[model samples]
Target: MWVLVLFDLPTETRKDRQVATRFRKSLLDDGFSMFQFSIYMRFCASRENADVHARRVKKSLPKHGKVCIMQITDKQFGMIELFHGQKEIEPEKPSQQLELF
Candidate 1:
């Protein structure tokens, strides 16, 4: 399974920018990879693990902006199509198989 987080936080004030930057750092520290600006994804071993990460994301969400957490199976995540500008780009591969839990 995969845990995907999408967020948009106000960055007008210095404090707001600091908060936003801290939130992004938290995601990386929690093992999420940046999928795009304000978007992050992490692979989990199971739905339970994904839920744990989803709740973590919820807890770190900024008070000023909207945040969304979604869970998808490995197959569904793998099915994603990708493109960069006018050229196609390879989508992210799922986590290595049979990783020691």
Candidate 2:
């Protein structure tokens, strides 16, 4: 299984930099590879391991920060591919449909 973790921190002041640094370091200690800056991570492990690591990462973050974890399996990746292949809808569709009423 692959787990992707996304997080954001409130940047009210310079303090956010320190907190973000600590959070990243904690994730690293927990054996998570950095895929992006507080955006994505890849962890190859079992579901239980992923959950435990995600919780630890969340706990290590600052009080004002936000974190989200998503576990992806092979089937989920296939679904993503299907969704990505869909065409985009025109922006005017909603208004045009409403006017028909």
Candidate 3:
């Protein structure tokens, strides 16, 4: 599964910028990688793990902004088509994770 965090936070004031920066930093600290300017994604081994991260994202959300969290199966994510200009590019493949009990 993949957890995608998309947000549009205000940055007009210094405090607003600080809050936006902190939110982005928190996402990175929580293992999400930048997919686009406003999109971050993290790969999870299960739905439960994804939910955990989603909750964390919610907890760190800015007071004034729009944020969206989405979960998609590996198959669905793999079907995404990317492009640079008019040239097509392959989407990144998810790394295999090893879990130990």
Candidate 4:
């Protein structure tokens, strides 16, 4: 299985950068690869590896920040790669639609 870990912090201050670096190192030590900024993709051999990595990351993040883990299938990974190859498209509408009677 593949796990995608995304993280967000309050700001990109020096302290935040340090924390992020440490977090990345920790993930690398646990055998995760960087997929994007603040996102890590890992190929886990078993559920135990994923669980351990999750727990370690949860414990390592700052109190003011957040980390999210999503398990992605091989098909999803391929879709992600395909999507990455194309330019981003804007939404059709700029404002929310309203209904009135």
What candidate 1 gets wrong by more than 4 Å, as runs, is 95-101
lDDT of each: 0.89, 0.64, 0.95, 0.69
Ordered list by TM-score, greatest first:
3, 1, 4, 2
lDDT of 2 at 49: 68
lDDT score, residue 40, model 2? 57
lDDT tens per residue, model 4, 1-101: 56778988666688877877888788888767776778887766556666777777777777677889887654555554223457653322212325354
**Candidate 4 lDDT (Cα, whole model)?**
0.69
Q: All predictions: root-mean-square deviation over Cα?
A: 1.7, 14.9, 0.9, 14.7
In model 2, which runs have C-alpha deviations exceeding 4 angstroms?
74-101
Which 10-residue span in candidate 1 carries the lowest summed lDDT?
Answer: 92-101
Question: Which lDDT value does model 3 have at 61?
Answer: 88
Top TM-score hit:
3
23-69: candidate 1 lDDT, tens digit per residue: 99999999899999988999999898888888888888888988888
TM-score per prediction, in order, is 0.90, 0.62, 0.95, 0.67
Query: How many residue-pair clashes does candidate 3 contain?
Result: 0
Clashing residue pairs in candidate 3 (N, C-alpha, C atoms within 3 angstroms): none
Off by over 4 Å in 3: none
